[model samples]
Target chain A: MSTTDNTESLVQLHNAGLREQGRWRVRGISLRVRAGEIVTLIGPNGSGKSTTAKLALGLLTPSEGRAERRPGLRVGYVPQALAIDAAMPMSVDRFMRLSNRLDENTLVEALESTGVANLRHEPVTALSGGQYQRVLIARAIAREPDLLVLDEPVQGVDLPGEAALYQLIADIRRERGCGVLMISHDLHVVMAATDQVVCLNGHVCCHGAPRAVAEDPAYQALYGKLSPALAVYTHHHDHEHLPDGSVRQIDNNASPGCGHDHG
Target chain B: MDDFFVRALLAAGGIALVAAPLGCFIVWRRMAYFGDTLAHSSLLGVALSLAADVPLIPAVFTVSLAVALTLVVLQRREWVSTDALLGLLSHASLAIGLVVFALLERPSAYLAEMLLGDILTVSQRDIVLIFSVALAVAVVLLLAWRPLIAMTVNHDLAEAEGQNPVLAHVLLVVMMAAVIAVAIQIVGVLLITAMLIIPAVTARRFAARPETMVLFAVGFAVLATQVGLWGSLQWDTPSGPSIVVASLAVFLVSLAVSRGRHA
Candidate 1:
């Protein structure tokens, strides 16, 4: 809690809860994201991961406690899934400019950064699953937001693509120095890059450093045997595959170390 | 062309130009049924206009807007599924309109004219009204274009990125209500949604960007109006139905062309 001083905190939730239709979707949730930090939310379905994300993004006001954002904070978000109807013809280039008007250089740079520059003019409907996810991320970062919130950033991708995506997210944090809040169900893949993991089952079951949460009994009960696998994934990945098919060694000193407190 | 035909063409063209962009969002959001609901409610607007002896356009706009807002509120409640709620409102309004028409002792021919619009009977004043509303709608759409597209792509993404998706949604609904109110004179309650949907879907085959799709939709809609009006004059057919049929023909041809390209 005392970590709130030095770094600029982007969004903070204090015992925040959302009530819908006489039911508390999530309750007693406390979370924070600071500049250049990554916080991931891991939970099963109907556990209010999305609702919690919404509250943090100020999309939904908490019915009980409070959610606050830095004044004039610019945000970039990638939702869990975006099914662009075939009836709405949209190209990757246009989709990137959906919320803001970016100059040609900024647009191309964002696409290039995500390694989807080749697909800039391609129809969004024609993209492969991995390609679409990259384009979504590219679109979000093009705004150069103060905070980036991604909901299940790798929903339908293959295993290799999921790891690559997590790596890409980590790289984005390194480059942009923006705060990141991610929601993921893939604990094994997401835990590698996540600094903090809040495990939720209708509420915050356990939350701490990824390794700490992975060993928590509550997290083990919720995720069962998956926690051990997550521990191994978090412990062993000293390197990651970049989007350009290049392998990059993780610099423990510079990069957000795998579940280790930089403090 | 006779004066009446000119007025009809001008009015229909204005409505088409505005409706096409809104229709793209409708198609993207898969709100064809929502459009149908609003169109159906326009019948009740007609009834109210008749009952109160007030101006038709404002009455229709008011009723449609009210119905749209009610739908928004009801959706938040989640007591009933969205499709069921749509069906309930759609049929309820239509039945009420019919009953009210009967209670007023209006002739069946008048009711028939309302159901199957008499575009050739549009007055100069009606043309003025249509253009005014169309201009207003065009301005709002231009201003709201990015947010609307962003929301359609993903509502949560739009909201999290500091864009006002709810405001964008409300603005879109209001514009739709305005278009439906003005369009009721040309296409009537029964066929108004056709003007909003057919051209947008047709435009989907060729467009590679959202803006291109909107442009293509406008072109298709205007072309349909012209072709439909000409065909009606040549064959003594119902003008509104002729326009819808023309748009349907365009859509079918686009489908064939797109299928052939893929093959």
Candidate 2:
């Protein structure tokens, strides 16, 4: 909602929906991701968070409505998990180069940015859950995409590690100025960085600026007591803890920081 | 070596060189059954070739490609489970091929040769055709390697990153058909999947990277071919089945060694 009107929109889904096997998977979803903006989709199991992400990425065609993207848009995507076959041995370095041919500098810089440079030669199957997720992010960012779509990017990490990963994502957005469309079930972790939150369950339930969506009665009804934690976290986290144990102060003056009372 | 022996080596080695890398994709995608389905359909290609008086390799490639496309269309339609559909297609094609062979009134000796390859009788022309197709396949695989690997690692990620998962998938199917068409001469319809799977599985034990796995697979495949040919010369066993047995032996050894390392 804070994105300037002149910012280019990387992807847009207009009343988009997909039908599978005589049933609608997700319907009536409309959203836009503009350059340097972050939009998050949050929903419960089987609520079509991944479906919406796929629809936005044009990986899945909308059965009913429309999904559009800028011509020749470059996307960097981190899926929930890659189910790599045990029979296929793949090192992190090879995985990084899977989608595009990156120069040595770009490849190394991406890995270093994600703090997975040490894992370059490590077999992907041998990586722990968190390390693998970071490697996936590294692979995504290596392409220097115009849009970044991350589906459950923090699925396997511990709480502290999840925070660090989120910080890393924020940093990437800040540095690259690319539009981000993310899917998450962890409302509290995502709400702080998300400009807009679209809560979905087969359809968009409520969508607005993150704080407004978190406080919406529909979102509260769907998520129960989790809404309070989201509000509190967003209000308190004005500085981010980087992965290397450094603190970076977010520019709270540029954006509203709990200027209105929650109670 | 005798002229016939040399021709056999060239023909089988050419097929092995291409089959090994494509076989790794088949294994990584868990499409061994799909490969089996394509191999089974190659019998239909043979029957058609015999009945229509067309060239064998082209007919086999056409039929296998058709079958692969049909499988994709049927899978999208979602009529039955993938495994069940594969089984149905595999046996139906084989039975139809047998019926066609019977109707054509081919001698059982010729049919036997087709079913269990007569690699020892490989001619200069056959060797030439084998290598031609092999070279073309290898070139395409090299060019498409990154996209194919991206699709294998994760379909949505590949698509999101502008890799064109569908195009990569179609390329893979076409390459698999090409390999199957040539491989049938060395391994036969009954054992072609073994030629395409066993070496890749064997390679999985020692490889830490995808390309390394592919290289290891090619090495194992060539070793299996040579060992099987030597065994055939010594004991007068069938070459196709002998090659499969040799590769199976290698796979078993790898399985044991990997398990030993872990234990």
TM values, all candidates: 0.88, 0.89
The lDDT for every candidate, in the order shown, is 0.83, 0.83
lDDT by residue for model 2 over A55-93, one digit each (tens)? Answer: 988888999999999999999988875778777788888
Of the true interface contacts, what fraction does each candidate have?
0.93, 0.96
Q: Model 1 residue A99 lDDT?
A: 81
CAPRI grade, predicted model 2? medium
* For model 1 chain B, the run of ten residues with the poorest summed lDDT: B112-121
| lDDT measured at residue B185 in model 1 versus the true structure, 0 to 100 | 75
B28-109: candidate 1 lDDT, tens digit per residue: 8989999999998999999999999999889999999999999998998888999999999999999998899999999887
Q: In candidate 2, which residue pairs get closer than 3 Å at backbone N, Cα or C atoms, i.e. clash? A: none
lDDT of 1: 0.83
Q: What is the C-alpha RMSD of each candidate to the true structure, in Å?
A: 4.8, 4.7
